[model samples]
Target: MHELSIVMSIIDIAETHARNASSSAIEEVELDIGELSGVEMASFDFAWQQATKQTLLEGARRQVNRIPGKAVCLDCSASFPIRQLYDPCPVCGNHLLDIVSGKELRVRSLIVV
Candidate 1:
């Protein structure tokens, strides 16, 4: 799964930063995963468990902040929450939209020790 690759990338990023900062271990890691980021939570968790072994993040406390999808209808200028990218606007039932958030997939912060 691609989630495994994502976890590996996260580990690589944390290790690189921790090493650059002269830290021996990572104490905590915070991630912002949006609803429309296309990552399944169960799969991501499983991948994390398998990928972190013997790595710098093995003992790190991970905190994931799930962000909900939100968008604005372009045709009706209505704001609403969206669960999918193609979700029509609730007010106008229009397909055109401007995504406001929920496309994020990034590491927010890390506590290195």
Candidate 2:
């Protein structure tokens, strides 16, 4: 699945950074996954385990920090949390909310030793 490729990419990036620091091995890979990022957390975790099976990150732990989706209303300047992509602003009840957060999937940090 696509998660395999995504996990593979993550491993590659982490490996590069870990090597740069001269770390013996990567202990953990931390990720910030926004709620609206369209990534299934459990699937990603499973894919990560499968993808890193023979790589340097084989036993590396993955820590996911889930970020809630948020939006700012352009009409009322109100901010609200969104559960889905098409969710309207809770305060203004408007669809003109500008997305301020979420829709992101990236590595935030790592622990190496």
Best by TM-score: 1
State each model's CA lDDT, in order.
Answer: 0.92, 0.85
Lowest lDDT 10-mer window, candidate 1? 1-10
TM-score of 2: 0.90
lDDT at residue 66 of model 1 (Cα atoms):
94
Tens-place lDDT per residue, model 2, 1-113, is 67777888898899899989999788888898888888887888789768898776889887888889899888899988888878877776888878888988898898999
Our model 1 lands, by Cα RMSD against the true structure, at 0.8
What TM-score does model 1 achieve against the real structure?
0.96
